[model samples]
Target: MMKPVTAQDLQTAGFVPERRRGPAVSVAQATVDAIQTMIRTGHLRPGESLPPQRNLARDLSVSRATLREALSILATIGEITAKPSGRGFVCADPGEKPATPSWRFAARYSLREVYQFRHVVESYAAQLAAIGHTDPELAELRECLQTFRRAALAGDISLYAQADFDFHHLIMRICRNKLLVDMHQTFASILLESQRLPTERRGNLMHAVQEHESILEAIAIRDPEGASYYMRKHISMAGSRAGLPLSELP
Candidate 1:
């Protein structure tokens, strides 16, 4: 038997078995949420221009890749019509309105639920990502980590957040599955709202940074099972710390 690796296995490997996903918000979540808020509030009409990707990413506290993934997802879910090299994503016709109870339920829902959902979906995506990830994909993942480490050391919250979001965004790209990525993008806002600050709850940022390094090493080895295990542990640990239930994440 491949030795049954417990969370403790992470330690001897020089990594804590923290939840891999950490119910963190993806870049798509942040982007979609802003767009949805604008649409319902009449701030963004059917044909309004979205700010440029770089500017929007800065404003939304996400990365360009995350925003792009969100756009792709929104387009897939019929939220916005895309324009090539256009300034922003456009609003589509509002879909069928749900019942009042449904709306209320959604409105009251926390973004943590969204992150939880991603934990499930992206956990699976991580498995796929490990299988399909290429050299370029690995490089991108490394670059994101480097940016994240640099930002963390410098105590730059915005850049840290951006880089943090990008690391997972690149992992999703490794899945060779657009549908899963799009689904995540479609509800970007909920995720943004849910995973506001995983790192905030951490007692030590440098400790967390060290854990992230282990995750990247597993992915570089293309160890799908290992990557999936680490990701699940990371997400689950964060949820536990946040006092969240996986089933209750919505």
Candidate 2:
């Protein structure tokens, strides 16, 4: 059995303790770095629940508030996720290998070109989903819509980004075509970039949430034409908010 690691394990592995006299922000950042090191060193497994807040604060020699700030940052960056039970957070699952190197793809494309591709693929996905999805798939879309709405209202850009992807990916899955799904998966990093671009700018976050809701509403009605039209509108709006010129594709 893998022994459950503790704060002492982290210290034993050379995780540096934050200085009490340091600036609060610096201490918080140091806490984040130490926790990230713990993750890399296998002291903390992906999907493993962290220790209770008080215990972790004591272990790191910082106040619970500072520790919390660090955890929030981790959660935002896809490193960890809040447990469904609400007890605490857990490290995110490390899933299968990507078909391509994400960094290389990001290097190869400008944000402008990426959104153009997204508009083409995602609009088609919404059209197929409107005609082909089962009831359960529709339910899942509704759930993701609610999640995205909550994230937007809270101004959590990270959570919003995740929910945004989930909404689109679900559409692809319901489209029932493996090739479309594969292509979308291959371009995952670029899609993530497009999502980040719109949400990163001020005042665009809520705009995106509203736009997604419109797409979901269209999909829910099983209106293929409406779904495609709304998806195109959503992507176009996102591109505009990101300051990219989206000339209608030929």
Candidate 3:
């Protein structure tokens, strides 16, 4: 019978050592190494949800942003999976073989291209959301905006990014366009990368809060043109803040 892995097990696996901090990105990479050590040593298993971010960050003596970045890297490589509802990430079976790569690589675009595409689809979706969303959908949008604002003000980079993603995702969902939503889903990683950039700059985060408020208000008033306008402006501002070149607005 296997013993259930505890925090002591993680410590034994070298995940609890205090390390000298370097650059932010490097710290994230080190965190990933610590987590990989935990998995290799059976301190974490497939399908096991890791500890809450707060606990893990405290234990590792790293900021939550660094921890989240490490997890994002793991998720990208399929060593873990993010829960669809923002619950948390779960560990993947390390022994499971990865699938063969598809030819979709031939059609892959840069992050900038993906951002351009998002600006087009999401702006149009915002317009549709304004014209078609019900009262409940509008309420959900407001809730997402408030969640984002709170996260931003609290300096919770990971939660703020999640809320920002949820707000745009809600817009696409209520847009009533399956094709648009599918497109957004396909470029989800690029969108996440873009959104993460703004969190590094407080000005960008606060600006996003006001921009989302305006966008939601436009939708609330059932003004499709206003919705489209604000959405476009919001995306443009976000791109600029992230140091991405502004693309032609839709």
Top lDDT model? 3
Q: Report how far off residue 227 is in candidate 3 (Å).
A: 0.4
Q: Candidate 1: misplaced stretches above 4 Å?
A: 1-108, 240-250
Ranking by TM-score: 2, 3, 1
Tens digits of per-residue lDDT for model 1 on 137-240?
A: 88888888888889879887667656756666677777878887786667665554333354443223343456567667777787878787777655654443
lDDT of 3 by residue, 35-133 (tens): 877877766788888888887887778898888867755655456776767678878886663442222223566545656777788889999999999
- Better model by lDDT: candidate 2 vs candidate 3: 3
Query: What is the lDDT of every predicted structure here?
Result: 0.58, 0.73, 0.74
Candidate 1 lDDT (Cα, whole model)?
0.58
Maximum-TM-score candidate: 2
Candidate 3 global TM-score: 0.55
Give each model's clash number: 17, 0, 0
Q: For model 2, how does the per-residue alpha-carbon lDDT over 132-234 read when each residue is reduced to its tens digit?
A: 8888888999899899889888988889888888888889999888999998888786686667665643332566677777888888888989999989877
Q: lDDT for model 3, please.
A: 0.74
TM-score of each: 0.51, 0.56, 0.55
Q: Point out where model 2 deviates above 4 Å.
A: 1-106, 246-250
